[model samples]
Target: MISGNKRTERFRDAVAGFEAAVRAQDADRSQQYFDDLRRYFGEADDQDFRQAGPRLAAILDEMPAAPRATVAVLVGACVERGADPTPCAPYVLAGLAGALDDARAFCDRWAATGGGDFPDPQAEEPPEDLLDRVDPDLAVAWLTLHHWEMAAVALLDHAAVRTALDDGTRTRLLRTLRSVEEDSGYVFKCLAYALLVLDDEPLVVLDRPTGTGYALRMTGIGDNFQLHTLLADVLIGGGHLPGRAPSAEEAAVCRDRPGQVDTIGSFNLVTPLGDWVWNEGTPSDIPVVDGVRLLVLDPPSYQRSWPAGRFFPHMKGDLVLERVLGADEARRLLAGCAAADG
Candidate 1:
């Protein structure tokens, strides 16, 4: 039986050999190298192999220097294993930069060999220009991972409406969306809200009155006001009325009628309130008083300028809280109106 150190050394050698074969474009050798790796890593289900899987850094060290090709391989591997690629992004980015440089070099060589008929491929093509030559769907796949919205939009624009995405590409895109969604909390909902506006999806007022302005609010998750603000901006950017940014009237109302708007939306973070209101009964049992059609509740534990007494009643009893309001009073007031309308 191989000692751990010996096994690790063997793995490293196999990885180096595999990468070299890939660089040389020797298919038979590459296949053999991969077969060795697979066997060493063990037949997928081997307990020892699973427990002793190589670190990401080790795997990255063994990958070919060609960025694009290596990224493709890594992405393919991730899809095959049903794993997220986020942990590997830094490595992927490094590889992509190398691949892009290699592409430039290859273009230069091609033009030189073609005796000046070919355009100088080394010229820094506008991202738009690059979009023209590469598969637009693949470009979108990569750009999406980086949250390069403008590039992704442009790439998707170039893609044929009927173009089919490869399974790997589709999975990567979904993973990217999920990552962005998780990072930005309500961003996906904001985007959906924006698309709804575009599709003429009628916004219904929540239980609140039509003239009442409402905002979606969440408890602060760290110093992450920027994420919340960005989400709100995305919703407004979608060209909808009563946008995420409070209009003058809405702002004025929040300032004048502080009692009507409940600030703080989500309970994801550990606020001074200690813990979240997990049981629906805590929120549902609260009575909704008249004049305030929408009552905003803070986590019962949060001690702030907004007294818990004002909103807690609305959350109790059979009343089901339809929408969450953010900690920003102005925004919550606005989103409450928006939710009601939707």
Candidate 2:
């Protein structure tokens, strides 16, 4: 049996060689290295895949044209190993639609077949709590659901991907996605919104940023670790609800019947837009001024917020970090701009 360190070392070496071959455009060498990488993936434990997945994905992104078969392999291995597919989502969206279908199929099969009925290692013959006996695969799948939400959001904002996909392709992809019944409906809504963007819904700047001392760049928004919490909250209809407080009767209904109605945070937007609600994790159909929209990432107690505001120029394919703007400057620039439609 290979020791964990030895296995990891071999996996890393294979990845490095594969990256070099791909960059050199040496088809035979790349294929050979890919075979080695696939073998490692097949033999990998959770820790091995977790460490290698992102590195492999980053390399794929830098390639001029990501190999579809290689993308499919990485996605399939992630599903089979119960790893998060987030890292590979860009490739999946960029025309390898079947990969997403295959991953979803694997997820569905796992759900139908026992869905993790492993015996509890620590418990007695018959475990009292079924939760304790859940197979790690199911737990990993549950965690991956969160990643799926982010992926869905990316699909919405990926303009380059939309340009590559025609109407028929978008429709087919949407149908494929709808065929799968997930554990939660939130991802479906997010995905539906993304599909809408692919069809005809023009991508617009959704918010106006406020707050001082914010810097901006053009890079992946996921790099902003601080906004993760806020983004998740907004995605799940958990953003601040302002206006008049809920009536006594409304409060009682929410308290007594929790699942029936969605709950929301009891705060107001720090950077309030005229009458816009920041519920959905999307930009509104606001008119873009000179191909630019304002995005603000304001944490509760601002410490060292770099991108407190971003000036996005009509992004279509890959999302980037645009230039930064001060709070006062951003507000001044966006003062006259209004939503194209409600």
**TM-scores, in order shown?**
0.26, 0.30
Error of 1 at 241 (Å): 29
Off by over 4 Å in 2: 1-91, 94-96, 99-186, 189-218, 222-273, 277-280, 283-287, 295-342
Q: Kindly give the stretch of ten consecutive residues in candidate 1 with the minimal lDDT sum.
A: 310-319
Could you say which candidate leads in TM-score? 2
Task: List the global CA lDDT of all models.
Answer: 0.32, 0.42
User: lDDT tens string, model 2, 90-138?
Assistant: 5545533543455355455545655654322223343444335344434
Q: For residues 141-252, could you state the per-residue lDDT of candidate 1 as single tens digits?
A: 3333332222122222211210222445444444544443443232332212111111101111121222232333321111122222222232333332232342333222
- RMSD (CA, angstroms), candidate 1: 19.3
